[model samples]
Target: MSTMDKGTGATMRQTAKARRRQAILDHAKRLFAASGFRAVSIEEIGAGAGISGPAVYRHFGSKEDILAELLVGISEYLHAGGAEIAGIGGGSEGAGGSEDAGASVGVGESAGVGAEAREGDPAGVLRRLVDFHLAFALGEPELIRIQDRDLSALPAEARSSLRRLQRQYVSLWVAALRRHAPGLSEEAATVTIHAVFGMVNSTPYVVRRIDTAVVAERLRTAALATLGVADVVAYRK
Candidate 1:
């Protein structure tokens, strides 16, 4: 094959591999959410993903590896997303802003705030964080359920890494909250952030019963309220 054709073929294979890996993760997440992690086997996950049990090993080392990737991958995603929303760089807590940070953190920009104001405004940041989290909670309730019940199923090193990433994500909220409420203590901010997370993460149970849009709005209002912000109406869709 020509060089260009060879490159195209390699890219296609990589894309297919990624899709298969994601399918396995998706199936494993749902199964683990329904049944406990220890109760779910690789054979079941592979079957759910429409592959033979041994085919799973081509994507992951074992069942525990799949669980580790699911949990750690989401944690990393959250950490990176929080950093982006907060206009910070990489995994560090340093001061830097993304080029599109304003757009990313403007979930409530409809309130007539300019991009400049939305970029690092504490209220805008908090509102944006709420909206960002609501998207994940509503769309991936299976991951939330799995994390809630099966986090301990991960190996010790993976669990520690997940917790560290989680702490960093929480710190973003704490920073934003303290910026909005100057008098708030670090302990208070951390506690309030966790409370909002618990409330938002509870969507897996109620999503089937209520309209997702309504559930999102209500959670947004309650989350802002928990942060002592009174202007949820401005952020309403």
Candidate 2:
């Protein structure tokens, strides 16, 4: 065979291998999301992927490793997306200013507080928080479900690393909240941030029961309302 032909054959073989690996991960993610980590096995995943039992081991060491990859992969995906959004000038022009206007309105109706609390524009931060969660949650529901449900199955050391990544993700939200709601204590902001996450992430499971178009609209409205941005924009006058 010609050298060029051999090179093309090698490339095709590698592509096929990569596709098989992805197929396994995709099926495993579905199983994990439906049945949780403890109940799913590598053999089941391989069977679903139409691969032999031993072939699964060639792609991943074990089920825990697959779960780790899924969780960490999703975290990394969101982190990268957030960085991209942050770089794109807060997702769009005028978005930051509009967010600030909303925060101002929120402060006007609240109880009296010191100047330190007023330094950060809480409304703008809340808008970014909503945007971030909506982007992340909507992009990867299967991965999110695996991360939330299968995390406890990871080994101690692996769990520690995963926890750090999870904390970093949380810190991004907390920091945004701190900037927007300067008067709010960190503890208070943390709780609100988690609440926002709960509302955003739960949409996937809930929306699946409805039509896709309706689900998208509901998600957009719910995210904006939950983050208090809707009120801010409405009260801008």
Candidate 3:
């Protein structure tokens, strides 16, 4: 093969390998989300991924490594996704980004909301964030479950990395919120951002009593109000 052809073939091989690796991770997510991380076994993950147990180790050294990759990968994914939502160097078009974010977090699309906020549309930016994260909370409740209950189970380095990514994600919200409410201080905005996350993250528990549309609307409004947008009507739509 020509040198460039060889390079292309090698790249294809790597891509194929990564796809197989992700298949394993996808199955592990379902198993981990359905059963607690501790309850899930390597052999089971292998079976779910249609691979032998020994083959699983070729992709991941151990079960903990898979879990760590899952948690850390999602954290990194969320941070990157939030960066795009907040317009941090994310240019106007962001469709491919939408898919990557949704896939990494084990959620589907965010209703085609990859568009950057309109010029002079600060509320638009905030709305984008609210809409995006609400979709995540609703669609990936299992991942959320792992985040809330099993975070401490991760190895120390992974746990720390996860926390760091989470904090960066919150900063994206804080930056966007400041545009809507200039009076918001760093500390106040941080608190508001954290509280809003807690509010939306409650979706899994409350989905039974109310329609998701209603839940999403209430959260968007409440989050805007929390950011001190007194007239949230303009933004809630």
Candidate 4:
């Protein structure tokens, strides 16, 4: 066979492999979210992904491996994305190369925050952070369900890594909140941040009942209000 032919074949094979791997992850995420992780098996996941049960092992070591990728992957995405919007390096240098998690890849800007947001500006950081989070909360509620219900199912190392990334992500918001509302004690800010997370992450429960755009606006408003930021208005889509 010609070298060009071989190269094209190799590229096609890799593309197919990549698609299959993503299919497994997507199906596994849905199954794990719909039924708790422990109750779902590799066979079930493979079936959902349109492959035979044993074919899954070619892509992942075990069910827990897939779970780790889903959980840890999103965590990494969130951390890296937040780090970018906040205009700083990630919280820690680690085995994965950076801190992070997430689904949608862009930062949304609220009308109140304006379009000329510069990096390192506190209000700009906070506005982008809020929109960044809202995008995830609304776009990937299933991951939230898996996180809430199945985190303990992860291997110890994976669990620790996920938690570490989460803490780092939260710290980004805490810093922004305190920077804007300097009157808030650290404890108060921490508590409020968790509250906002709980409120936004509750999308899994309530998202189906409302228009997603409306939900995004309300959540943005409530989050900013809870954090007591008066300068940024709730962004309307």
Best by lDDT: 4
- Each candidate structure's TM-score, on Cα atoms with residue i matched to residue i, is 0.84, 0.73, 0.77, 0.86
lDDT of 1: 0.75
Rank the candidate models, highest lDDT first. 4, 1, 3, 2
Error of 3 at 87 (Å): 2.2
- Model 2 misplaced stretches (Cα beyond 4 Å): 87-129, 231-237
Candidate 3 residue lDDT tens string, 49-166 = 7888889998988887888877776666566666766657442132245456456546664334335544667777777777677777876777787767777779888787778778
Candidate 3 residues lying further than 4 Å off, grouped into runs, are 1-16, 90-105, 108-118, 205-211, 228-237
Q: Pick the candidate with the highest TM-score.
A: 4
Q: Candidate 1: where is the Cα deviation over 4 Å?
A: 92-120, 232-237
lDDT of 1 by residue, 113-176 (tens): 2242346588877877787777767767877778888888899988988898888889988998
Q: Candidate 1 — worst ten consecutive residues by lDDT sum?
A: 102-111
Give the range where candidate 2 is weakest over 10 consecutive residues by summed lDDT. Answer: 104-113
Query: What TM-score, to 2 decimals, does candidate 2 have?
Result: 0.73
Pairs that clash in candidate 1: none
Clashes of each: 0, 3, 0, 10
- Candidate 2: tens digits of C-alpha lDDT, residues 121-206: 55554555455556556656776777777788887866876676567657666766666556778888678667777877877776
Model 2, residue 222: distance off in Å is 3.5
CA lDDT of each candidate? 0.75, 0.62, 0.73, 0.76
- Winner on TM-score between 2 and 4 is 4
Rank the models by TM-score, top first.
Answer: 4, 1, 3, 2
RMSD of 1: 5.5
